[model samples]
Target chain A: MNSRLIIANIIRWLILLLFQILILRNMSFYNMATPFVYVLFLLLLPFGIPNILLYLIAFGTGLTLDSFYDTLGVHTSACVALAFVRILFISVTVRDGSDEPEPTLGNMGFKWFLLYAVLCIFSHHITLFFLETFRLTEINYTLLRCALSSILTLFVVILIEFVFYNRKVR
Target chain B: MRNLWIFISRYNAFFFFIIFFTAGIILTVRNNIYQRSVTFNSTNQVVGDVYKNLNVLKKYINLGAVNDSLAAENAKLKTEILSIKNIDTTKETVVKDSAGIPQYTYLPARVIKNSITNRNNFITINKGKADGLSAGMPVISPIKGVVGYIQDVSEHLATIRSLLHKETYISVSIKKNNAVGSLIWGEGNFDYRKAQIKDIPNHFKLSLKDTVITSGFSSFPQGVLVGTVSNTGISAGENFKTIEINLFNDFSTLQYVYVIKDKYAQEQKELEAKLTNEQ
Candidate 1:
């Protein structure tokens, strides 16, 4: 990757991490819908980044967020799961021959971006909420929280993409 | 050896993922109530410092509400003191006895962090070992109701396993007849106002608004108010009654709490241990 691209990605990582810990950490709608936009760091990683590096980045990001939330390992487990399956998600969404450099609204069409974001966010939320609750008796409540939070996170991710990366069309 | 090295290099990502995922799961289980592991939790210095700083800003926003509650608590305490003074003067002519000596003392603390939504919730307080706080001490809210017990304590912070936690159980009884039972926060008990009291015999005459208090068999003092019985029922094939209680202290916005230190706890525990050994 070019030095400029690397610097931009680093900056983006810091901004997302700070935004999640300082602001979004305290923002929960009706005690149910908690948006986790920090996953965008993993979602927007350059396509074909080394799998080992991608997994490490996801684990590091999740651990940092977990420290702030006081949930020691729940976030790390969910983020690693998301990172592991990210390649499969990309293969399913991207065309067989299209060599998309990244999963962004500008690089991929809006429909593809939406599908990709929804799948990733849902997986992350389901893993996170279930692990956090860790009980079968309250399955319905956990499911409701997972679904609502996933939707809220998806909205925030899409909004960020549209506002910040709108001019960089592929 | 070359082929083995190539294989390891090719699938290193999978290996790393498995290792890290297993570590995360282990940490989760260790910190859970089952293991009761005190390490690797948010009570650590780094995370606790960040939370403490954040709470400083948030505390200002809730200053008005906190002040109101404190004032209400003060009014109730004044009445209690007056009544105690009246009883003391009336009993001055009676013979003094060792039983009259107080057995418990209170230590005040502020709740820096708390959660009611989780199945196994915990509250972090600002007092710890340095402030004469230790594990197994019963904690009470600003009011008379029980909050929880101190589960883990560091130098400057302590984690309380709140009453809302599923694993929590306290020996409790009806204030009128002294009908004894146990209080538990059962599954599907999402209402912060309610808790479950099991083991009360079905034949007892239970009525609405009946008061429940700690039985003094456990960490808390006898007659500490728990709540009032709100609903009661008898499940099929069971000989006990299921009583739902509406707690007096709200857990959602708890600010100040008092830790109860039993001066005679060690002596009682030693006697119990001796009895067990004799058996």
Candidate 2:
């Protein structure tokens, strides 16, 4: 509703998009290392951000990336699932009524935050590579891509949060 | 009613995410329609420009290697020219030039990017519509030998169906014995190819290091070197002989290429089409 919040959302989303397209895309190590930084947008959203707006933003971001990659909907599916499950991850990790200001990676401690982020990202990537491969014959490759991408994405998310945000609140 | 509306609104995000994810999976399943999206949704102007810039940068980086290759090819060509300098004969064939040579002209190009790890690998070439290149042209790496053939064409850009593609079949032959075979890459990696010599009847003593050349049955001309025989065996359950060829081209580092464009391709395609229809 506020202009500041809208601008913040736009800036954050744009940063994620650029990171996905320009940086992660070129770092395809061994063809299986697909780093996905778009999930960072979901991870960094305000703690009580409305779910509907979150879904819309996540869908738009993922679809846009899929368009660029020439993959029809792998990113879309993964992004949506990531967005939906992201809240569940936050709730499980953060204690209730602890006066937690927000749940950025810096606030949550890198190790704990990384574990949570990796789980969510891994789920998204597994689903994505599975659908892309479309058969059990490529199970090994699909699994490798999912794991490698998750590790790289986790590192990118933590690094971005550390660089941009103050680490005083959790 | 108010509570129900509140509940719906609260869970709307979850429903939306599920819907969108399902929609994405559906799109993935309907790969044909999704593949069509490439024509509309892809930002050609932006992607094309970026690719062009990268191609230019790559060309600059590979200048030394490219120059060396051109020099080597030039020396070889000069030797051939000197050998046949005195011969003067002319005969017209389907794809022959005015001097009775092949109508095809080779346009040297650099591969901007190539994907071989994927099931359907495609190579991007630097030359395109502006370079007298059209679809269905065959691309070969002069230094490493046969690479692949052109598949899709765009302005100032083209996609090559690399030899690693499953559907790709190339007409090839044994250069030493003139035994004909079909060169195909039905497995992983560009280092290897499966050559099926079905036309060659059994009883020929095929051995290792027998040279494989383009059979000139397809778009590729005669004597374009393919590879040497790595292994030969009878099909476990079939009568035909299958030869495994170790491809000379190192696809992992394909920097330069020659796009072969036959001047008579259109006429030949039309005649072949008519003949096929008649049959």
lDDT of each: 0.84, 0.75
- For model 1, the superposed segments whose C-alpha errors exceed 4 Å read A1-170, B1-43, B88-90, B93-101, B235-237
TM-score of chain A of 2: 0.85
Cα RMSDs, all models: 19.5, 17.9
Candidate 2 structure lDDT: 0.75
Give the candidate number with the greatest TM-score: 1
- Give the TM-score (vs. native) of candidate 2: 0.49
Q: Can you tell me the CAPRI class of model 2?
A: acceptable
RMSD versus native structure for model 2: 17.9
Candidate 2 structure quality by residue, lDDT tens digits, B20-86: 8888877665654644454343567567668768777767876897788779889998988886765
lDDT of 2 by residue, A9-92 (tens): 679888878977887777787787878887777676766666777777777777898888878777788878888778677666
User: lDDT for model 1, on a 0 to 1 scale?
Assistant: 0.84
TM-score of each: 0.51, 0.49
